[model samples]
Target: FTVVNRNVVFMKELVNKTINLAKLNSDKIPFNIETISLTDEIKNSVVNNQVLFEENDIVVENHVIDEIYVEADHILLQELLNNLITNAVKYSLEEGGSISIDAVQKTGSSDIIVSISDTGIGMESSQIKQAFNEFYKADDSRHNLDSSGLGLNICKRIVEKHGGKIWVESPGKNQGSTFYFTLKKVKKEPLKQKETSISSI
Candidate 1:
């Protein structure tokens, strides 16, 4: 009965992922953009996933600078964080694994770069390059067990929608990995367009 229930839940999640991917591919996803505190949002995501970390005996850390605000769709941003953190937890060991979330403003740009680092089964150079590809899974053996290969793809779409870029870095297998994404920061004051009047010649 337990196995059946688990399978049912997995199937439901798979269906939802498939629907979301379809919506993304068809350019039908809607976003409600607003200015939000990045640090608070990230902390909330971590808090939401506390059970997962606790169950795996993993340590979660935050290095986000306070008062970092950005223009983003709150729901999509949360989804992005959830996907990244889920990946970190999935590949990490059952003990002594640690995940860190960091955010900083990009020099000379009104943008913020966020990274999620994990001490887990890291990827190779080739794997890192294809990490955001649709249906790309670094570890095929565990794909069905924990991943549908659409999470990161969805994350890439969401980031791009916000005029941001996402990428992954790793030293080598077992050395750990870090996924970084950039988002435009909310301007202190909104930009205003100047009006011009036509004059008779």
Candidate 2:
């Protein structure tokens, strides 16, 4: 039986995925947060978009904010982004739909927000509210697959572990959706390990 964490049964499993991805990508990519272009990466990847989005479409845009960088686990970030993009690609239409990613610094807050917006099948308010629950799949089409229905929850745990929050938004059914999250900006300083001292009880 899998160990369950409070509020999220998939927490431990998600961490495992992140760690595994980190080990796999350590030699090829970064493990800390850095400014990146979503379009550049996805457009260059082997994964094909199930939906063909039109040129100049505002499916998703990785807007830059004066090169702002957020504190994040890079390798894990890749996995999270990979899962989200893959899901978007799978759920989107086969033509004239696009997904864009945007990163921006939150005003009056020392955090960076990343949003992935897509033009595809939108979930209702109820579905949107419960989408992040583990093993919760609203649509049978998405449920009847070789999935654990834990991607969003996994993403949520990873984000929280990295001092961030994840959430989704949708206007209503058939309306496009956006998944957004925030990451705290970590200062560039070495973390000091605590020195253990013996104490008399």
Q: Which structure among the candidates has the greatest TM-score?
A: 1
Residue-by-residue lDDT tens digits, candidate 2, 81-194:
776765554455445366777777689998878788777677898898898776676554231112346667667766765667888887866566888888775454533333
For each candidate, give its TM-score against the true structure.
0.87, 0.62
Q: Which stretches of candidate 2 lie over 4 Å from their true place?
A: 1-60, 94-96, 140-147, 186-201
Off by over 4 Å in 1: 140-145, 188-201
Question: Model 1: what TM-score?
Answer: 0.87
Cα lDDT tens digits, model 1, 35-105, are 77888999999999898787777798898857787877777789899999988887775454899999988
- The local distance difference test score of each candidate is 0.80, 0.58
Number of clashes in every candidate structure? Answer: 0, 8
Total colliding residue pairs, candidate 1? 0
lDDT of 2 at 153: 67
